[model samples]
Target: MAGGGVAGHGASAGETKLPPLTPGPYRRRLGFVALVATFGGLLFGYDTSVINGAGGFMARPDQLDLSPLGLGVAASALVYAAVIGAFTGGRISDAWGRKRTIAVLAVMFIIGVAVVSIAPSLAVVVVGRVVLGLAVGAAAVVVPVFLAELAPYEIRGSLAGRNEMMIVTGQLVAIIMNAIIGNVWGDQYPWVWRIMFALAAIPAILLLLGVSRMPESPRWLADKGRDDEALEILESMRPPGRAKPELDDIIHTREIEKQRVSEDIGKIFHNKNLVRIILVGCGIGFFQQTTGINSILYYGSDVLEEAGFGTGGALIANIAPAAISVITALIALQMMDRVSRRKTFLVGYALVAFSHVLIGTADVVLPDGGAAKPYVLLILIVFFVGSMQLFLNIATWVTLSEIFPQKIRAFGMGLAVAVLWMTNGFLTLFFPTIIAAIGISGSFFAFAALNVIAFFFFLKNVPETKGHTLEELEEHVTDGSIFHSIGRK
Candidate 1:
């Protein structure tokens, strides 16, 4: 459970008692609201990853005449835009409130997808991707905060982590959808990409409408000293007798956050320990992308086709990894709260990094085409996706939410995710060129090297965030033991 203590100044001592928290419908209501808002995650996953399926069609040797470098940069622009969006979204969420921030992002989602759907040229498509990237970045930040604020401490990690799982699921759906449509339509209609872009608006519209009916993050309200409002919101999420303790915990959390922000960010920066927290948060994201997971996800069809599969074979093969992601995501959702975040990350990185090394070795040994060679690589990639979703991807997002202090939670998460998306953008934009130059062996080797670095980093610094409430973490943050002791107990 979340901890409690005196939070700087003094907590209010009003005569009014907090309402009781109940289970049943209250918890269900909160879960429902979280699901609705998390449509942003779905769209974020679907819209950005849709390009992966489309890439084969767009940059084919006979199609758009795109160079390897051109393919990469076009793919990368969206991620770069998302970095900017994620960074700005953090500050904007602070000022605008979580629900409102998401709404604004939904608007961006609509417009960005619209532009991409109607794009006349590759440059215009990149423009649309950039705009869509911004929305994805903002959603990545806001959705977790929304879920964390509303969920009970017992379920917070799992619920908060659900957004990421949804993101992977969305990507799987988009990839499948793209494959089905791209084959049937062929550019005779030329509107398949448009449909792909426009489909995002369906989720965006759902996000806006769902959020309109949803309450704001109670922690945000409580931080502004709106205990009554926060309690009311919490009540909507709890049973008749369960609201008060939860409210007390949330209020306790808010006060500490209020106190911490009063310190200077620059002064905090001078503290080497805090810098370590910042570095780990940023590094987690960097390593996450450098694993070349996105390269696989955003260009699965192309990668498969390059290895001697037909377009149809490539599409079918692409679905295998995506299925692995969705299945593992469902399984991981069940384990997120049960497992320690650090252990999960360690396990994930070890498997994925090793898979890359194995894939490289396979390329060297198989030399591209026995009857069994593509089949071997295909199964290996499936195992890679399984390892990624089961451990690292979910754990990385969950740990990011866990590692930062509440006061700088948004700042830390936002900056880390921005750095993540930027790294993702650069890699996505240039992967075609890189793959062309170094081939599969070289690409996997690069990923393996980075994941090796990531392994030691996590073993040394990453927190274990299995059972603690955000409030329980307050003391560690204030005392500067955030890395030393978090997630251990």
Candidate 2:
């Protein structure tokens, strides 16, 4: 039904082929946009963890002039903002379009970073951090959804995988920067952490430009009934020669759009099974945060020091978990496409739980001044981070993206992630209190218990979505089969 075709413009008379989707300039354009938006991941990592060095300056009640309560408020205000941002970001994206939503998020990142850089008071810093956190939450949820929808299901995991990889890479970069800066110039310049905070704008600006040029999701375009526009976007996705096939796929999906709800949120709520998926998503997300991963991320050095490491020892040891995370993640990226997501989640929970048990035993069994104890506990922590990256870190986000029907994909995923961030917020807010009340051993024992609970939940319920197409998944999951359980019919 395509109009401009003369039936002889390089395609056969009755080929029914999508004009050849020959490789072209469009993919590069998409990649550029995707990478730019990923800086949200960058800013997210840097804002949360880069403050490791800033804490001393921030804690100087005598010098910097702050109380413990003020510092705690400053640290946690961003999480609050993130919850608000995540809740509202999807509605804005639906109304304004993905590119515009991302552009606004970039502006927020820039403004927030700049604000944090100059804040002289705890109150001002809290305000800035909250602004930054809103940007983080929105970016965290939206970027992956945007990228996943744009990417062909063939490479969806690898493509969407980039965001998580970039996030960890950003954390690694921030940690390294903090270490180098804190070692050589942080004490002297003192405001170096501030500089780090403000520098996030560079990526923010880049993302603004990058996402602007890319096409909207063809599916999204089709959802709005812009068939011609959707086909045009789909045409650009493939080589111009393959447009017929590509457009047909898009058109086919569009024709079925009405069957899925225009109001996706309501549809998801009505489906009991989907509600379960959402709960699973929320459970995994919340458990992931409650595992105390953020505790180490936000205060690795402090945690290490409390284990009896010296001042400098804390900094060196702090990088260990981040390092462990990156290495395991590299290995994980290779495995993500190969294994079942359910199995991955189960394994992750098991390993983290075991590590906590080991750490708890070490704390209870090892004498206070025992020479071999800290090193043993450190190894256990490295193992814990490894387990987290291998299973929970990459897999949790991947599965959340998979479980929902196409109609409610955004609401389902966003709500789950919101729960994740909120749990993260509470944990970040109360980690110190927990540590004070229960002691290190007790804290770890609690995490181990949570992981045990997660293991059972995932074992009985988590579906495997490895290597399935979005269309295939939408059909398969509705049958009550989790991703891993779906047979290749």
Candidate 3:
């Protein structure tokens, strides 16, 4: 259960006693709202997997005619732009509101995807990707925070994690589409990659129409002194008796944040506690990309081709990792609260390290063009992706969303994810070069070494964020209490 000492646990002198929490139709309503918001996640996923197939098509002789370096440039443009979007989007979410920020991003997604689908030149393609990258970066920062603020602490992991689930689902959709299109029309059709890029516009449209009907983050309402409105939203989403107490907690935390002048990024450095928290947040974001997951997602076919499969065989085989991501991500949703964050991360990095070692060893030993090489490499990639989805991806986002105090939550999360996107951009830009220069054996081995470092990082820094309301967690962060334990569930 979520921790005690919640506000309104004992009525203040003049406060009326509230009734016990009860289930009602509003639970379904909240679920619906969550589903609508997660379309952004689907868009995120589609954007990821679409590149896997589309990048290959775009670089063909008759297409954009990109060089290896140019391919990296075009592929990483959005990611680089996303770094800008992530931080600015966080500030925008604070100034405007989470709901409005998402609405604006939805419009950007449509525009960005449309631009990419029709680009006749590499320059225009990079331009389109930059536009879409902004939306992706903003969504990465805002969506999980929106879900976290709205959900009850006990089930917050599952609700907030719906974004990641949708992300993998989007990846799944892209994989199926890529396999079908690559197999059927790849040779004959010149414009099939455009179709893949265009598909993202559908969900972007849905998000625009749907978010208008959804409620704002009640915590944001509370932070802004709109107590009645905040309480109304909380009442609708939370259990009856639980809403008032949670709102009280939000209000109380907001007061503490004000005392410390918490929203200022510079002030964060002055406070040792917040500095520590942000470091951990940035570390998780940094290490997530360093795992080389995007190398596989953006260039899976290329990885398989190197492993000794034909182009067609590689495209089909790439689906295996995508499928594993969805399945294990589902399993992750169940484990989010049941498993400790530190333990999940420790185990996840360990698995990733082992998988990389196995892959690198196999690649080194297998003869060139060996029949079994692709099959063995494919299995190792599956394990790598499955562990990532289960332990790192969903869990990292959830922790970032919840770790900071109410006043600086948006800014803090933005800074952390900006690091994530920036590192992701750097890796995506160089992955093909890395693979070419080092070969598969050396590339995977390098990542394996990085994961070994990541294991120690998780052990030393990450906090236990489960089973605590956002306010309670804030108290822990402010006082440096969370650093004391490993959440040894």
Best by TM-score: 3
Residue 405, model 2: lDDT of 60
Q: Candidate 3 has what TM-score? A: 0.96
Q: Note each model's CA RMSD in angstroms.
A: 3.3, 4.9, 2.5
> Candidate 1 at 374: error in angstroms?
1.1
- Predict model 2's lDDT versus the native: 0.72
Model 3 regions lying over 4 Å from their true place: 1-4, 8-22, 487-489
What order do candidates take by TM-score, descending? 3, 1, 2
Q: Pick the candidate with the highest lDDT.
A: 3
Candidate 2 local Cα displacement, residue 55, angstroms: 2.0
Listed in order, each prediction's TM-score against the native is 0.92, 0.89, 0.96
Q: For residues 360-474, write the lDDT of model 1, one tens digit per residue.
A: 8998899666787788888989999899988888778877777666667778789999989988888887887788899988999889989988888888877766665666665
Each model's backbone clash number = 13, 19, 0
- For 343-458, candidate 2 gives per-residue lDDT tens digits of 77777889889989998898889887777777887888888888888777877766676666666677777788889888988877787777768878999999999889888887
The lDDT-based order of candidates, best leading, equals: 3, 1, 2
